[model samples]
Target: RYDVDAIHMDDYFYPYPIAGTPFPDDRSFSRYAASQGFSSTQRGDWRRNNVNLLIQQIKYTIAAEKPWVRFGVSPFGIYRNKRSTPDGSGSETNGLQNYDDLYADIKLWVEKGWVDYNLPQLYWEIGHKAADYTTLLHWWNANNFEQPLYIGQDLKRSVDKNELDVKIRQSREMSFVQGNCYWYGYLMLDNYREVYDHLRSQTHRAKALIPAYTHMHKGRPAKVKKLADVFTEDMHFLTWEHPKQPRNPETAQRFVVYRFRKGERVDISRAENIVKITPDNFFVLPYESGKSSYTYVVTALDAFHNESKPATIKVKL
Candidate 1:
């Protein structure tokens, strides 16, 4: 798990098909039907059970390895369409549901303390005739338990009316949500400039550490124990060290460098400007003249995405 911080399982592993291809599940289905007494009409139910098992297993894997680390899953926008069942997740559109189509029992995963957080991909807006943002927001709110809840807004669909309502609701949800995860760190790139505007603004991401995952484990980094070195001659290099985070350190994949630019804490989130580092529980920033004009800090993020508070270094001018 050290390969990544925060298990960002997107709508992958099993993708929805194109017009010609079918989701090849005959072998799994036959086995499942034989083992669980599942009938053809009940295939969706069996599939859901399978996904639940996967979630539960992964949860145990994290617990056994590093309980405090974080886990996240970005599911399809619709869990279930209203017309399909009595307890349908009433949203617009008769689309494939995560609960039914993909077999992911997302809501129950949260209620049962299996997943650390959930970022439902609600790309539609409030006024949308189908799959309105308000509908899913309320639906998610009603079911939130000990875990965190975040909305995954899509950048491509951002400029559209239904997508814009998502931005409005995103702010509103924060009062109730843990945080919102922008779909792909890159999608909010140039292609989705309008939607990117909504996220890059100063008004967004107002919190530090989106509510703690109480269900996983509450672990803190050992303190910013020392600032070892600072260089400023040719370029600049600053180094700081600390003990491992609460979870097993191996699960940490990368670190985010934070610089106190004129007292404003700035994290390099852009692709071109950003520097990647191994999640070794230490931060080393190569000096850049125009980078910033303040102190520097470092934080560790594990594969399950347990982020440490900034370990600061004040650069002497």
Candidate 2:
């Protein structure tokens, strides 16, 4: 019953291997592998298939229940080493792989469109001995297959090496990489090495909307109606009404508020102009002395981040 935007699975599909000891799934494999047409020799394939089945089932369930809720995977950085794959469709780095070691066919899942997005955890520093961050970053970008790809960075490593700025800049340079997610977000909240200040003042100064899922739904929601300002002794706010229609893809799930100076053009496309994005229809206006007037534009956003036409209102203080 929780209202969640996405269902995410991290890199925990199977247990990491213990040296000189097997995974101890022999009994389960022996009991059910044959019924699925998997031979005893194909135990590894069977294990990968099990994870594949789970991914497919989750995709189907989300599509049926809430098509707007995206299904994404943050898999282990390396899919496979080149030496392990027959076709050599693997990265050059030699490391434990999601495909072989963890029995997760991440490439297959992405290619088959079974997941909405893939964020590979490349938690290594640049030019590392085993799994270099830049090497795997480029590898994932090349194999994204038009699916959204985000990088999962380790907060401590990036900050300690002073590569946080470098890594973010590198991802932005790549065409297919959409964004980056930090591991152990608390480090950022705690402002480790002033990383939070750096992001707020420089890298992420402008507000950005989540990328729209055009693959699922390409339609925009209807624009809001009756946009007006309300002024009272205790509070001054702007309020608008949703479009008169039944709840559907064309109905507003949230609203985007943008503010522009009196003489400036009302451009909703500019991320810097965005004041707030909220589910509530009302937005509290901050009082600013010496500011005589300002123009505010509100737009409706559907579940997929598609925005509607702007509803404008000018306030004179």
Candidate 3:
């Protein structure tokens, strides 16, 4: 009984083209192509069909089990070059095309709603000749089949302020482009090139809720049934209870705690006002004041991060 939230596939569908070595799928194709109604020259089409079937099958199986779980794919940034496929390619680069070279129909998968999100590995810098990051970023953002778009960023190249600043500006300017994820985990943990400090102080100062997948599951979670607070010797703890709906995809999977000054407006959507997002019902607040009155609000987040109405409680410490 392992609970999984998301399934992600990277850009290894078909290996990159070497100089002269073939991919060596001939035997498998010969065995199944005739029965499946494909000819010898239709090897490319059959291979693409095989990958497409696997993609759709995985999506359906995940939906049948847990509708909230998302299936995402990170394909090579260059789907096709305009020179090769006039009708299919949009970008101006001559890099290896995922559709033609790798036999991966990534655009089709996104257009058919088989994948929840598409994160293209647009890892090059802005002025690169072959695979420009800026060019590909705009290309994918414009063609996003109405799903969330997050780019796979390169930490090494983005260490330069000029490069990172441009990426940050473009990512924020594009409305559909949600965010970007670093390529590797250790780079972030090790703070390689002080990239972590720059992110913490500038880009990620406050916590934010993940973008919701509204197409999979919509509507707000049910409000909490009880909200109360308790005070220890030097710590403050807030506890809550919600109506049970374990199997319902719209049920609360977590709670967001918001704290406000007595006279300040209690805006739960504001990132600065949020204290924490907790899986458990209780949260421990920082000991800021002993004689201050605080207004706290708790909201429920469903499996897809759809938030519910707030339940407010005031405490005078």
Estimate the TM-score of every prediction: 0.63, 0.92, 0.92
Cα lDDT for residue 156, candidate 3: 77
Models ranked on TM-score: 3, 2, 1
On lDDT, the candidate that comes out on top is 2
Model 3: residues >4 Å from true position, as ranges? Answer: 160-162, 232-235, 244-247
How high is the CA lDDT of each candidate model? 0.62, 0.90, 0.86
Candidate 2, 231-304: lDDT as tens digits: 89988899999953323655788899999988998888799999899989999998888357999999988887
RMSD of each: 6.4, 2.2, 2.0
Clashing pairs in 3: none
Candidate 1 residue lDDT tens string, 197-231: 66556435332433444345456434344755555
Residue-wise C-alpha lDDT for candidate 3, range 6-69, written one tens digit per residue: 9999999878889899999888998999898899889888888988999999999998998889
**What lDDT does candidate 3 reach at residue 52?**
93
Clashing pairs in 1: 4-303, 6-303, 6-305, 70-304, 92-130, 92-131, 125-162, 236-287
